[model samples]
Target: MTASWTVSQMPDCTDKTVLITGANSGLGFEATKAFASNGATVIMACRSTERGRRAAIEIRDSIADTGATLNVRQCDLASLESIDAFTTGVERDYDRIDILCNNAGVMAIPRQETEDGFEKQLGVNHLGHFALTGKLLDLLLENDSPSRIVTHSSGAHEMGEIDFDDLHRERSYGKWEAYGQSKLANLLFAYELQRRLEAANVTDTLSVACHPGYAATNLQYRGPEEAGSRLRLGLMKAINAIVGQSAAKGSLPLLYAATARDVQGGDYYGPDGVGNMRGGPEQQSSSEASYDRQAAAKLWERSEELTGTTFTFVLD
Candidate 1:
């Protein structure tokens, strides 16, 4: 019988460098805090320096240890320029990134495009991470020990359909639809990356995906706020109170994916409860669409075209 997985089982990560995006709050913050508590050198990458600094301070206080090191870097996923600069600084400072968690994202919202003119949700949630991961691939492979690229997708992917003809929703847009598309794209990118990495005979790098499974966080409010739907927001709040798990509870899957000793590449994890939306972490399968290799490759090609970021690592 499989035993329950818990954060208490997280392996010691002393001196390991773990970088988490959107670490300013919610699940990201919880993940960062847990990593630090377990002795990992944490990089809290956020779009806002003010918020990042504040978050780092809070984690430091919580861990209350002189050995816990937290670095805050400014990276705006909406702008490739910002991502480039941020990676440049990271490469200059750190020789290798043991764990790179693509955890930051934008949820459903008004039809707004990013600085690069892609839909807001797609740009920040998918393309931006695509660019960052491409830039950091070398650093990940450079490490002598095993490395991990953990992508944060969502359960909403079940409702997602990749409309290649309208990835940016240029033809039309619905808030949840856009969010679902991006979330689906996240899984596609993650699984495809793992496949490519394995095909290259590359060892030491594992690409994993995870979802929070109905956790309550600020991410949920983005859509309702953008659409000015008070009733929706109130309903969401009530549902969260009634059924949604805490942010820390929701973060279990991500933390488990990041730190588990037995985790394998391409593994997808989330809540084990009903609908896979509320419970402890467990390895689970994503939607059937997420397994479409042809669609995944197609999405990869489009991502390269749109973001101008290509995975250049040799698959030899």
Candidate 2:
């Protein structure tokens, strides 16, 4: 595929089932619309079922007669119990999942703890998806053909370091630092997952990571809105207008990773623009730290201990 790959280049997704977290808005929502328009059964796993339903209605109204099947289910990544409920429902209703997008995340908000007491950014962005994937592993593995798990990370991961001594940031916390840690954790998990699957000889499943470089989305405004700082919000709007790409454009890397036939596990995709910020999706290398196998192993063990969910695979 060319570096300028677009959704039009995607394979026909008919008869496929895709589960996208945070599907009510941003990249996930755009992905939902794209996949559904191509005749796939799209599950919108959202934190708010009400918002999810409204988003579904909007997609249906806009796309008129694409034979899209969309289902909205509630899944709050900040809460382990909510993920449990969502995954359980999915397991009961769907026998196989062709794609799973671990896309929902919280950005640089004021430091807070999740329902399970993890740092908010690390909790929602990394650990939450980890637990959800473990719980739904059976459905993904059930696919006769290869299934894809596309994780959404960010370029900010380059600035991150896994503070093993203080994973929850109870000692100190800067919002951006926490966000970076979470994003870096995403890559580590994606790569490690692929390694584990390969070690177990599980060829029918692929794990990949992608990022929407500097995409303009609600995520930009969320932190300022949460902080009730209009100044920060206004600055973000200005930055978005001048420097950011459209969410639809930013979402292409994820769409490419999810559906591209040539995609391989452990691959990372991002925009091909200057500094990897804004352009068509292309295969790219993540930070050197993201490939640290030792860090990945430690994080994996800590995550399982914290989330009480362990992924089991018989390794050779």
Q: Which candidate number would show the highest lDDT if scored against the true structure?
A: 2
**TM-score, structure 1 vs. true:** 0.97
Worst 10 residues of 2 by lDDT: 307-316
Which pairs clash in model 1? none
Residue 156 shift from truth in candidate 2, angstroms? 0.2
lDDT of 1 by residue, 222-312 (tens): 7888789999899888888898889988889999898888899999999999989888888999999999999999999999998888886
- Give per-residue CA lDDT, model 2, range 1-316, as digits (tens): 6667887888888999999999999998899988987888999999999999999999998885767799999999999999999999999999999999999999999999999899999999999999999999888988788899999999999999999999999999999999999999999999999999999899989999999999999999999999999999999999999999888898999999999988999999999889999999889999999999999999999999999998876422
> Which 10-residue window of candidate 1 scores lowest in summed lDDT?
1-10
Query: In order, what lDDT does every prediction score?
Result: 0.91, 0.94
Collision count of model 1:
0
- For model 1, the superposed segments whose C-alpha errors exceed 4 Å read 1-4
Best by TM-score: 2
